[model samples]
Target: MSSTPKRVLVVEDETEIRELIALHLRREGYLVDDLGTGDLARTQLSKQPYDMVIVDWMLPGLSGLELTRWIRTELKQLQLPILFVTAKTDPEHVAAGLDAGADDYLAKPFDTLVLMARVNALMRRKSWMDSFNVESEQSPHAHILIGELKLDRDAYEVYLRDEKLDLTKSEFKLLEALMMSQGKVLTRKTLIELIQGDGVNVVGRTVDTHVFGLRKKLKDHSELIETIRGVGYRVKLLNG
Candidate 1:
């Protein structure tokens, strides 16, 4: 049986850029769907599920940020990885892109190698998550409970004091790693490896972004996941 190729949607207004991205992704063995506008991309997204999306910051009909927000809020695809590429290289712009729901940001004149690395990392994470979900479904005990927080791996659900908590895929993965380790302090590198797998060149700050998002969703019980100063993070154990 032939394996299914991963599908990627590239939304870039510049024809040259879009074609370049699509060509590289295709060479990497991914099925590429390229669109010139955010509006068209949104329509395509509604038609079917894509493994990942690469969007430009500026689009003709809708901005990349707007499209990302829609994907997160309207489509409710928190697990879907979105990468933003643009000329905006300021720190604030990068932060805005992440806050707008992009999993990764790349400035214009980006290195093709770096772009491929990020794409591979996101795809690997998604693949791992899909496999984990399948395994959890087959396992009898797929749930973990720490304090009042409960994580059901099989259902891909998290509950705080019986109330469901909304979390992004990255946040969920971070929480899962911490909760699984219990009292063990996971270094940022370790956490990144656990979440994104090894060989993925993800910055340490990326982990912090996911942690911030996770903590925000954790709310009052956010303290359950403690940050070890200059070390990493851990889920507070019952005794320690």
Candidate 2:
């Protein structure tokens, strides 16, 4: 964790639930930001940065999914931890929430323990990634150049043929890991740990979806990332 307390934004339409969530977070000593509508949340998000956000699946002004998409696509805060809370407990609903970019989900009427557990886990994951990036930046060699693809660890950016690439945080990390490993194939579980932090229970399939998105963004250079059937993925070995 940083020297300062992590700030969290809670976006729930219910005043009671919003306050309750904030109360629980404050009890744990986190700074809290609250919003009752998605639009207001969006505006606040643009003006400030929060360490995490807890969003309701249903909200006024915009649904949770829409707000999540806006954060990812517009704000480009792909690394921000999002915990989606909703009454919808169906499998498809859960899948939709994850696909829409939530790092985790909690059903309504949730126990504070479970909610706090997820929140703590996400914070840990964030800390781990931050530390990992710092370590990478400290490395004397901070770049991987493969054909038109280049990932610069110094600037934390990716470029293809000199054009900057807009990749989500996970996608950028995934590509970096793969390109760095080069010929070594990485299992889904291994890739999860490499990107999301060990013991972070992200659904294994989430790696697939992230890879799918990364591949699409890579466009004509997408062929460089090779799927290894049941094993996982690897960057194809380059010829001498």
Candidate 3:
């Protein structure tokens, strides 16, 4: 682990729950910051970087799902892990929370021990991502600019026609892979590895879901991503 203690943001409207979570995290040597509303969490996020964030489902302003999407899409903090802690424990709600970009979900009444385990696991993931970024930075493909598309690997931001596009972590990874391939067709299996890492059990159709999201955000620039008839997708060659 890095010498720096992991930083965590806990967003919960319930004061007692927020403080309790913060206390546990602090005892585990994490630096924890707590907020009472989703809007406040957004403000705090813009001002500082966090290793992980724990968000409640119901917040005063944006709601947990909306805030999670904002963190992924607008803030582009795919590297930052999010754990959802909410009372909504139904299957559909769990699916929705995961789909909204939560790395893990804990229902209300969850044992604090379970919460700690999830937190530790997410932190391990964070460490791996940090190491991966360091190695990737050594490559020439770290930064790309062609036509109006610009991708800043260091900043985790993607811009099309000078406008930044809202993207989830998967969508961002998928786009990065295609653009870096430089017009080469990437099969679904290849793309899955690029986005989800080797040995990850993600089916190829998961790539399709992410592509659909990327295209939606790309809007008029959606044509830049070309789908092959029977294989996968690629980016059309474009001149800067």
Which segments of model 3 are wrong by more than 4 Å?
A: 137-240
lDDT of 3 by residue, 1-240 (tens): 467898999999999999999999999999999999999999999999988999999999799999999998899776678889999989888878877778777889878997897788668756644554565544533667757778877566799876888776667777876776667898987675545421124578888888988888888878989999789999999855
Clashing pairs in 3: none
Which predicted model would earn the best lDDT?
Answer: 2
User: In model 1, which range of ten residues has the least summed lDDT?
Assistant: 193-202
Candidate number of the best TM-score: 1
Residue-level error in angstroms, candidate 2, position 191: 7.9
Give the count of colliding residue pairs in each prediction: 0, 0, 0
Output the better candidate (1/2) by TM-score.
1
lDDT of 1 by residue, 1-240 (tens): 017898999999999999999999999899999999999999999997899999999899899999999998789786788888899868888778877778877778989998898888778767655655565533433678887889876456799987899886567778876776677788997667545532224578888888888888888887887888898888888852
The order by descending TM-score is: 1, 2, 3
**C-alpha lDDT values of all predictions:** 0.81, 0.83, 0.80
Q: What is the TM-score of candidate 1? A: 0.71
Model 2, 1-240: lDDT tens digits are 456899999999999999999999999889999999999999999999999999998998788999998887789776688989899879888878877778887888999998997888788767755655565533433677888888886455899988899986578768877886788798897677655532135567989998999999999989999999998999998776
* Over 4 Å off, model 1: 137-145, 150-173, 180-190, 194-240
